[model samples]
Target: MAEFKGLSVSFAVKQKQDVQKQLFWPNLKNGPFNKLEDPVCCVKYCQSVPNFAVASGFQVEIRDPSANNAVVKNFHRFKSPVRSIAYRGLGSGLIAVGETNGHLSVHSVAMRTELRHMTAHTAAVTGLAFLAGVVGGGSTLSAAPKLASCAEDGRCLLWDVSDPQGQPLMEFDLSSASSSTSVSAPPADATAAAMDKATALDASQTDCNLLACGMINGRAYLLDSRQPRPALVLSHEHPVTCVRLAPGDNALYVAGDCWVRALSLHQGGRQIAAYRRHHKHVTDLAVGRGALLSCGLDGLVKVTDLLTYEEVQKYEYPNCGLLSMALSPGEADCLVLGTNDRWLLTRRYESPAAAAEAAEAAKSMSAAMKDPYLKAVKAYQVMPARPEDVVAPGPGRSRRPRQQLDQLDRLLKKFRHSDALSHVISKGQLKRKPQQAAAAMRELARRGALATALAGRPDVHVAALLKFVLHSLGNQDMAEDALPLASDLIEIYAAPRELRARPGIRPLFERLRALLAREIELGKQSAMCLGRVGLLLDTSAAAGGLAGSGGAAL
Candidate 1:
């Protein structure tokens, strides 16, 4: 194998163009590699988030990302591709790399030249992570940072990387047993029991210790270091692509099914936020204050606000897929992005002026709520706009309750499916069973209640329309003509493509491609019809006005 940029760049050679055209070949100003022999699979920084201490490939090279395109120092060499690399924390100076040969090697970046090496699995190692510094009795404790590894052999083993050739701290073989109905579960067939036994064996390592393991089945298990068994197991519809523990926040972020879910241990396993915003498998995630950056095989990089879970920025590459991301340790605004093509990119935070502009946009939106219908109505404010205050009476007087609309708004805001349904029922919008509330709403919109109630107060307009459609369709007297229109509307509203491609709904993209095509066609037709009618009215009014003026003169 030939070396370019100090790492192996495999010779698949699909492109004959000069190396200068490839971003990875153009040595970064701060990159360490000068020669690479194989295509890099994954790269990471050893110091902190984006501070590059060591860049790993088939053979590892140690250098800082801030150093000027300098030669990489020998950290360690392994037999297989460096699939996973991790560092404990700032200043500890320990670096760990897992390779495809089922070997894990640890080196001291700031200390000894060669520290320790161990073969921990029979298959390729896929995952590695460092537990944060330990704390006990409300105070800090100092000890060697422990290392964890997951492999294709279906085992996760813990190692003491502070010393070379050291024994594994603990070992867990998750696939020791398959599904069985035996009453007397023998030791060989007792995987769960063995897991519990392992938990008890490692009880001394507990405090502030949390081990997360991702299985080949797309399941994630949170195991308490002190307990022999997993504290929680979450299954994804698709194989779990990646799992990460957030620094500082002690939160667990897992990505699968094209979504990143933030789960808080502080809240007793409650899900804090679900960012359903990517169209393909989310392969990696890096968390920082106020925001999160996620990338996947689809070559899309998205930054999202931690508080609101709204995507703030999106970047795409032509053929490169992102493999990992790290935030710069020294600067809050700087980020380091690594991709499958062996290229690295840097991004800084939005300028203060840009932030101020964003704030101004938000303020303008808040100020636009001049209509009472669009403004939030509290339970107390929902009380009859005082019947006496009305210039003319409307039908809502009898059906409207002070808290009903307010409650609907609250439910929608919280994503409380049942609560929103209760409001729909209390307002006598859906005559069907309350359990079918969401479905009823969908049915109602299909039947034209959506168009009729578009003018309703912002809080309940959507709810009322949904209710109207459901009631109209469920009614026995409905006509066949109405059915076709309702069916068309339903298909339009429920278009899978529209739902998935729309921002923040990527997790539900099962139907996006189909829905998007129909929506575009329908939109064009609607625009054409509206334009034709407007032109017709304009001409008719002009002619009538001209004729009336002449008659008046006579």
Candidate 2:
């Protein structure tokens, strides 16, 4: 904490909002381990719009970007914790909520009330997916969407989500279905019936005729909306957790215990490509544009290139285990993740056009009518303007202050300690020079928030900070200024094990015996310097005037 003040922050780390959207997730300053923290089981992006839904605690929160973070009109509460949620069509037309009690309810966001409440399963509903295509193989798409849901029992049902008095359109007990008909389950025993429970469901977008559900018995039933029998059965060794069909038609992505595999529909349910990085159970998968997004108990959200099935990028939340993931509709810019904690870790990559629209909206809003979504969006780093966005300013046109939110302040406010420290170190030309880094470091230190910034990070950035401090201390001219920071480092790392074993600490802690002795010698040198200063003071009669900046630093 003290070293941050004296040394330049030439080494910093990078990651984004908790603060990026932390304002809507409840500030992390509320303590990481709250008793009331609810585990978020499901999150679903709207099928036809930008808004999304989060199933946390006993309520399903509908977050709208065009409105407030939580759209009051679309908010729906339940008697039990919501297990899954889905939206029917564009502009939040119809919403479906599946509860832990096996009860599924439909609500119309435009109507602002519950339209139907019905029993869909005997146990907790695991998932609910909307059918985007129409029935009877027509060229026209259905004006009203159909919902496909699965529960703990051997149940997978489809319903008209727009119906006021709801009755399932079709239902399935896929327990008898097997990849090879000869290898069917050995006569449904009590345990076998329960073990073959439906774990996941998905309705294909391009082919309204296609729908699929994964079972705990390691098989996925690719069902036809028009028929009673499954058109195909895809087999896996691990219990299937999630199933997703590509928009291009029939490239199904299935995730199980530790691996994710792509299966082709036209090749007699042939295995196409397999992707595995998850050491634990892969919980959910979402099909994105040219990407297949997945998250698991491994605490990683991976983005795989759709064509190659090669990992494109992965986002890690240090200690958070993810349960569900969704990519927002419209621009598909927002990535919403539901963790095993109360918070929803949302990261949005707004393109240049989106950012400008947001800025324009912010400029139009008055203080009283300020949008909370806009406020939360402001916390994140704004996307840079593209070439197409460049414009020639007209005469007397004034610039707006709508998009200038302080990045470091937002990071600190959200308790993103690691990122705050990184932001400080990344200031100015850190690699070539240290002056700007020192100034930024001093700013953080002045606020007495240095401890928060230096806590809980045990990565390369912290190692870089340690090396920066050690190098700064080697300069006799600068060592005195950095002494406090060095002491703080030892205290923070030693007390919390924040830097248990890092490249930067090897030098500082490896020669502990010699370092201790050298500290004694340094103390002796400091005493000699003070004695000389005292001699200089004696030459004048100014008692306290001579002990200015130099004395202050020491």
Top candidate, metric lDDT: 2
Clash number by candidate, in order: 31, 4
Candidate 2 per-residue lDDT over residues 2-97, each given as its tens digit:
011121222321113222232321211211112225887887876665777777778776777444355444454687778878765654367788
Mark the regions of model 2 whose C-alpha exceeds 4 Å error after superposition. 1-37, 66-68, 72-76, 134-143, 161-165, 177-189, 350-554
Model 1 misplaced regions, further than 4 Å: 1-37, 47-50, 53-56, 68-72, 89-92, 134-143, 163-165, 173-208, 248-250, 349-554
Give the range of the ten consecutive residues with the poorest summed lDDT in model 1: 196-205
TM-score of each: 0.50, 0.55
